[model samples]
Target: SDIVTSVLDVSQPCEVNIAIYDISGRCAMERELEIDCRGEVEIELDTGKLSCGVYEVKVLSNAGGDKSRFVVVR
Candidate 1:
């Protein structure tokens, strides 16, 4: 699966940490990406092994961080 989101107000290039957590707060998937502060970032997630449920996504970088929730139907 793919997750696309935007990082706003970035002042410089940096390394961003993206992590997906299950409802129990356990880390299910994680990846590190280097971006040039271009405003939007698109990421690919391997969800084949993940169970159908609600999950949280955390995006962290030197500029800032954000959290959002998602659901997997299959």
Candidate 2:
């Protein structure tokens, strides 16, 4: 399994949303976090529960409208 993490820069305190999607493009897990300006965060993803295939991890900063994507393999 693979673990994914990312750092985001937010201008203000807001909610951050992270979602993990399986090979079928279905969201498997969702997490929300509160971040402050210029704050950094790390997220550990558990890929063991997923099948041996490709997965997509998306991070979104709700307040700043920022988004990022990552690929994971199990």
Candidate 3:
């Protein structure tokens, strides 16, 4: 049971990409998210479907072209 959260700073009308990868270095889930320009946006991840191990979470913004990473444990 792990939760992964992240925030991105973007201008008005932007799209963001979120991805989750398992310990085997393969992508497990991915989503294309849209964010409104103003404040921080948060996303939650459910690790129930994943095994008990370390996983990688990646967040990317289309407007600012930024990439960030997070670690998830179950």
Predicted structure with the largest lDDT when compared to the true one: 1
Instruction: Using lDDT as the measure, name the better of candidate 1 and candidate 2.
Output: 1
lDDT per residue, candidate 1, 1-74, as tens digits?
Answer: 54435344445778988898999999998888877756555566667778889999898987789888888885
Residue pairs with clashing backbones, model 2: none
TM-score leader: 1
RMSD of each: 2.5, 2.6, 2.4
Two-way TM-score contest, 1 vs 3, winner: 1
Reference-based lDDT, each prediction: 0.76, 0.67, 0.67
Candidate 3 residue-wise lDDT, 1-74, digit = tens: 36666666555667777787776879988888777666666667666677666666777765545445555453
- Candidate 1: segments with Cα more than 4 A from true spot: 1-11
lDDT of 1 at 72: 80
Q: List the residue pairs that clash in candidate 3.
A: none
Q: Quick one: ranking by lDDT, best first?
A: 1, 3, 2
